[model samples]
Target chain A: MTAVEERAGAAGADDYEARLQAFTGVELVPQRRGSDPVNVPMIRHWVEAMGETDPVHTDDDAARATGRSGPVAPASMAQAWVMRGYAASVAPAAGHSPFDDLAELLAEGGYTSVVATDSEFTFARELVPGDEVSVSEVLESISPEKRTGLGVGRFVTTVKTYRDAAGEVVATQRWRLLRFRPPGRGPEPRALRPRPAINRDNAFWFDAAREHRLVIQRCAACGTLRHPPGPVCAACGSLEQDTVEAAGRGAVHSFVVNHHPKHPAFDYPLVVAVVELTEGTRLITNLVGIAPEEVAIGLPVVLDWLDADPELSLPVFRPVAGKGT
Target chain B: MTAALRPAPASVAVGDELPELAIPLTRTLIVATAIASRDYQDVHHDPELAVQRGSKDVFMNILTTNGLVERFVRGWAGSAAVVEAIRIRLGAPNYPGDTMVLRGSVGAVDGRRVEVAVRGENSLGVHVTGTVTVRLPGGAA
Candidate 1:
């Protein structure tokens, strides 16, 4: 048989699409128990890795003061609790999971490349130490072949629900991914800028940027304002914090024109500047709407955004017309 | 000393080189850590799929890289030290059969806070390079 005939007989793209569609509403992971019970040590590790300072995740007294019984896990850590560590995940398992089957089918269809597109989560209750969590995932939807900048792919969405030992639902998450055929010769994969490491502390900042709002983190106790939100107040050491919308106004504090080590994702002679916000904080960002030579310290600038990728939106600074130093 | 114990902030000085930490990268480590971080991209766990995507093998996910960087800095800073911020940029991929060596030095010192300039290097080259700001105990008022 010819290659095309073999491929068609084995499993063509159309057959793969049909098979994938059949998986919608199918349970992928069924009642998978967490490798470890919710505890302070893992919470501590997560908070530290994410630069979170909220005391409730670590300090028992701080949690109690907030009217909780004790320290509670960060709501965003819902998935980490159920992670199958190196040993379990790599070891040969008993049965084939629906996710495995779906993945194999996609690979067979030449949609071997995959990337996570987005995830939405909702928390019903805070998890605490001793809470033995369990999770189950269901394939929600699978899109038809769509051409994207990356390649031709289908969007796969799944819903995972987390429950406590008593089977009480605590959190639910909608996860989406794109399974695509890697481009054979398409413009050397638009070099994707490295993804930002997001955790509980800084997630809200990115979320606000998605809506085109520039918000700054403020300590609820002493009212000191800070950028790049932290779990605790730097000045007052307060755990409680809030956010305030900025005017999106700032000025260039320092800058450097990068001329070498060109990354395909960015233009050459890139103007990278540190903008000093009117609120007295500094943010390192790209300076746009101006020439590299025009970039100068104290140059009055305003906030603009660079939709870096489908999933990333970064706040960039541009010189305010007729308001330069 | 174990990472659980706090190091005296007064004893740590600017320009002090932290003891290097070597972590062997295995296929399991690469894939498992990605799952732990809730990253399901096939390139991080499925080698066959990764090769099809142009990568020789599944690579380490960014979250796992960030987590390992945090672990390395905290291991040096001790349990009492609080990581205020960590900014990292990725370089070479950490494929299986490689050893990632984490090295750092105290970049700056300001009262309770010390900035650590860190880099994780593998056989291919730097896997990650970043700076971590940490607050050590006894120096805080």
Candidate 2:
């Protein structure tokens, strides 16, 4: 079998994982000391960048008045003190480091890239200015190969123990990284539109939309039409209900253009509008077949069907060309 | 400034509302806080990497979210307040170009200990919802 195919098989995976477990309990970093003692300058930069105004982090008088001896670094900044600076981070690592060894071993198995999945910190005690700190790390665990969104990979977990000059434990971090093979850029299939929540109350509306028809729920007793199907009618407290086929006409009552935190199913700069139907009820739906800039309040619109898929359909609106309020 | 200090133990009762704080989710804020927190995850700083990893843009990291929540609570509880614990879970991501408005209400109060139910909402939806437990500076009754 080819090397790549054999490494992907069950026996090859088992053989590879055995070597990874050998590094368990091995110290990756014996004692990497902080370049500088915990000081106000670093703390100041942290709080300012975070927009944190906690007096205990930077104001000595405020901290002293509050019972602390002086300013205390924010507890969340525990990892920052021992972080390798930009210069060291970009420089090539010395050949003797075990970190390089572990990385090389992983690369041999085709796990050449990494992404952080989770980090949990439990602080034993808060650090103060002028306190010297150092850190040591050991492999906590490495999972067998598993499939993930990034690709097939294994999880490598480690425990970093932070200590003060007195060797007392100040904090501990359980960090997990997913070392995976990069999935080359390929055209992903277009996402299907989001499905609507259909139940007995609203099944008829969607069923009608599936056939390219627009229907509204109407109270049988008082004839109050509602866009959303409900159990009881609000106008006359009637349980009796029926459906009314809409005239397929409306006007935009209000609208908004969505730009961020987007879903893969929908396009960006999406135009969503609340359309007031001719029957005196409103439905919140998306506007299709038009530019977002062309949508405005009181713009006349006509009903359109978005056949999202064979099993699902949605009612979207399109602005009527040259139609005025 | 004095008025912003610790609320009197008796003065803080259940159902009190803390003023809302709106934070603009700028790209600079997202990248700087991630680095400041020593989080080198590319998804929090590199927009291209973020998209490749299934995000529209670089988003705020959890550590930064925790820090923002702590800052919001401390601003209300005053200088003497101690953040005993912060328990939060992320929902929708806080992408750059959005504004996250944090709002909280007092849930439980046992003398100096107060529990605040906090939620941060962005343009998409609820981004973070969690409870922060703090100890106001005062003798326990």
Candidate 3:
């Protein structure tokens, strides 16, 4: 697998994809026996936790009625039987699994975090008490890169064949897992700021900001300027509206330095401030290019445009150099 | 226990609702079920390890969630129903002291097969949403 690591490091994305595709249909693990056979105690615990009160799972009479020899394990328990328990999972035995190799191969491409996206089980028969189950997994498919809300990830699907002691296939599972790059981890493309909800009322503001212009909605009837564009002017109760391009100067009327609950799009100790613009309208925007401690009420600032992604542009403020008073 | 199994596919209809099942998310449940399912991930059983791993506390493992989902469907569909498949997407984490109430509706019925759309909600928000496909024996699909 070290060879795989070296190749993955040197290869391009297409080469890596080809290398990963090579593992398709390859068995990921040897036929591994379950640590424990299907038994009543484990079934009891499982049913208890799951709130499964089906009598056939716990009553011999019910099992007889259901035409089983005795109480049978729930069909869903197929995966549980063959799990590599606490010991094996935390500290795997030497002669590691090929699945580990696949994981390492994926992590080389910055896909480290894993989450089960979907699973489908097709059952052949239910396991009665004392039936030993063994499982072997094969790489089924690897999807092309997908952009999810979580991050960029590739879905790896595997098929696990579960068999009883007689080597008869009892069930099989098609399992799909997303190996994603956790947010803010490992060369991830920096996230864009959460998109502001743009509608007829506020689209003009964002559109003006995109052109590096600071515009405020003005009431044509009463000469009142509003920071947030609205359908009707509050001051004069007028529906007539116009915009005025400001000189892009302001003072920090109020501000707060945020240290927790971070978003990947912005740096922190983020300075969010209410800037009182020279046009006499106060709008909330982020303050930039100044240390958090340097931010004070009445601090003179100048407008700047944050081209957040190719689509979004926001008006930000920064303390004016040489006029920090 | 006395829930009657739907003997015919015709007996089940689209838009049928399954009774809601609310499982109390106890700390014992989170730890015990994780161990029972053989998932030793610290985020499922060890609070300190979970905290270090960036989770606020021990959370339910996907396996246990799968089990519970199957149980939810079976408890309604009866023991004789064969669970052909389950496709679930997890959302909010089920932290301890939150109750996940599962509500499901029959989304589709095709002869012997029925698909139920299931949603489980906890205090944080939607914990899990998915669909369960169950096939009944002796149906003329």
Candidate 4:
């Protein structure tokens, strides 16, 4: 038998899969310090790279307009806060970790190369400037050896929990990696589209969608209702606001059929629409369950939930037939 | 925390030009900034991957462009100036081995609110064009 085959056979006989699975639920890395405090300079760099123009992340007045006291770091940046620089990765500190041990074991078994498969993030709150974040990683699961285009390998999944200086949980990430032998390469996978920029102003809106609830923010002072929840009421200029569950009914106010500059995360021709709710607020959302050509302005619609990725759930709109209301 | 450096609303006028600033782009700056922003897109940092994806090389991200625009406006508006709004649209990509020259002119002047028309150009052409509104000192909050 070939050397690789022999190693595979040996691994099987020794029940290496079970051995590796034992690491699940064990702490892999504890309390790794973030390279820097959440600051504006880094945030600026990020927004530039991502092409994000949200004023809440930069303009103080725009942030205050959304009811935030000041600037906020994008929730999608949770992992970036704790990234060890290239120098640290090249010359890591002399500390042994269960992560390193598992990698070594996988390498010994001819699964030396690795690539990130996907990541799932759950955020509890928006991170504001000056918050120092630390992270702890734990093994979540280890899959049995499976034959992939890259060769035989196992998927290693870990959960990273991020905490602020106050020890409040800010975000958690489920990171999965494929450890494989460096032969039999296949077609490259498409990268995920950048996640939505979530913060204190709109986090609750997203959270409510996960539970299949369509909610709109209402000014606690003047009873003005708004979608795309902001910090201040446009009419009353009140900072205090509350939420009201919607009847999930609306109509298409405007729309466009996207056919070019295609992003891998979505299918084209993608139907993007602006829907005006019965409550008089509007939202820019995707139109699903209907053909792009069938969509039109003033078409009555209803709310639907799109579990786009494992970690994200958003509200989409569907056309209503023979609408009277 | 200290005295404001912002020019008084009465002292500012329409068509006034803010001092220009030049930023040098390097691979480290590009990659480090992308990581800092929590952007892990290979096109922003991986030249080989970028080439495979049909880009000449790893290019600057829009977030960095927005941040730079904010920085330029804030630099001229002074420490006490509050940026009220910024609307920007991207054009050609800013790659390494080029310098982005940021220039701006006061578009309009209200009591305390000033609108600055700004553009950042690199060797390829215009990188970003936008307008920023800032509330200067002695202006209505």
- Point to the candidate with the largest DockQ: 3
- Give the per-residue lDDT digits (tens) of candidate 1, residues A1-325: 3323433443443455587789989999899888889999888777654544556668877666545688777555677888775555457456899878988887766777766554455567768999999999999998987887557878888888999999999878777777888888343324456788999999999998867788899999999999767899989899998899888899999999999998767778999888999998887888887988878889999997766555667888877884432
After superposition, which runs of candidate 2 have C-alpha atoms over 4 Å from their true positions?
A1-10, A92-96, A106-115, A144-154, A180-182, A185-325, B1-21, B38-42, B49-55, B84-93, B101-135
Off by over 4 Å in 3: A1-15, A144-152, A189-325, B1-11, B51-54, B110-113, B135-141
Better of 2 and 4 by lDDT: 2
Q: Provide the fnat value for model 3, as a fraction from 0 to 1.
A: 0.52
Fnat, 2 decimals, each candidate: 0.06, 0.25, 0.52, 0.10
Worst 10 residues of 4 chain A by lDDT: A184-193
**How good is the docking of model 4, by CAPRI class?**
incorrect
Task: Categorize the docking of model 1.
Answer: incorrect
Candidate 4 lDDT over A270-310, as tens digits, reads 99999999999999999987888889899999987766544
Error of 2 at B106 (Å): 7.1
lDDT of 2: 0.79
For every candidate, the chain B TM-score is 0.92, 0.92, 0.90, 0.89
List, for all models, the DockQ compared with the true complex.
0.06, 0.17, 0.30, 0.07
Give stretches of model 4 more than 4 Å off: A1-13, A184-325, B1-34, B37-141
Better of 1 and 3 by TM-score: 3
